[model samples]
Target: MTELVGIVLVSHSPELAAGLRSLLGQIGSAAVPVAVAGGTDDSRIGTSYARIAAAVKDADRGAGVLVLPDLGSSVLTARAVLEDHPREGVVIADAPFVEGAVAAAVTAAAGADLTAVLTAATEARHVSKL
Candidate 1:
């Protein structure tokens, strides 16, 4: 069986990142590798390249990695990590933070490839909330 794509959630708040990971845990996270890169080394609010890069490494299991960053610096920090370590299967998803993460995780758990997982994440932006 092909390895399932991994997910790395990047957020400015450690609690937010962890909480979402917990939520995904109750979802279809059994076969999905999910990691969080939230806050700085000092545990303060903000993003960290080292943390994000490490999470990506931890989540990846020979299939691929999908990075979902929250607002502002989280996005920039994720981009920097991608720049420093340009791996073939590591790609950042340009989608809403919470919705995208949930969608990505669900799709990836279904044994989808990186492209399908990415598409699921990005397409989440269109999910109607009315």
Candidate 2:
């Protein structure tokens, strides 16, 4: 069986990440393996490297992991986790958080490989909001 790519959403607010996850589920990608790493260990308004790392590990299901960060520090924290882990299939996508997560989740639910899922996510950047 083909392995489905997993997704990780990082945000400064746990509510944001969890809300995004719910939104993704409502959008029909609930089967996709999605993990959330929002806020610090203390549940404060800050990104936690450890939380991000754990989320990445949890989301990965052999295919790979796609990480979407909400803001600057969240992105930095995700990158730091990637740098420390240095896994081959893991990647931090430079795509809009909500759009990218939805795109990636849908693609992954279709059993796409890591590269294709990442492409779907990155492509979200060009989506017209008008």
Candidate 3:
């Protein structure tokens, strides 16, 4: 069976991540594995390395994992996790959080490969917001 790429949304607020997940679901890509790594284990308003690492592992199902972080520290945390784990096919997307997640999820749902899914997410950078 072809493995579908997975998405991980990282944010300082659990609400933000959950809301994005809901939005993605409403967009009809619920079958795509989307893991939300938001806030600390204690529910604090910050990124947690452990949480992000766990989410990366959970989201992966062989195809690969694409991580979308909301802010500065969140990106740092995600990079740290990747540096620590160094998993092949896992990537940190340099794009807008919500937009990237949606695009990546939709691409993954269509059974795109890891690089393609990452491209979809990164391409969110080119979205024209007028």
Candidate 2 deviant stretches above 4 angstroms: none
User: Per-residue lDDT tens digits of candidate 2, residues 48-115?
Assistant: 99999999989988999999999889998888888878998999999999999989999998989999
* TM-scores of the candidates in the order shown: 0.97, 0.96, 0.95
Query: lDDT by residue for model 3 over 28-54, one digit each (tens)?
Result: 998888899999889889999988999
lDDT of 1 by residue, 1-130 (tens): 7789999999999999999999988985767999999999889999989999999999999999999999999999999999989999999999998899889999998888999999999999999989
Candidate 1 residue 78 C-alpha distance from true site, Å: 0.6
What is the overall TM-score of model 1 with all chains considered together? Answer: 0.97
Ranking by TM-score: 1, 2, 3
Quantify all predictions' global Cα lDDT against the true fold: 0.93, 0.92, 0.91
What is candidate 2's local distance difference test score? Answer: 0.92
> Residue 28 deviation, candidate 1, in Å?
2.4
Superposed by TM-score, candidate 1 places the C-alpha of residue 92 at a distance from the truth, in angstroms, of: 0.4
lDDT of 1 at 40: 97
Off by over 4 Å in 3: none
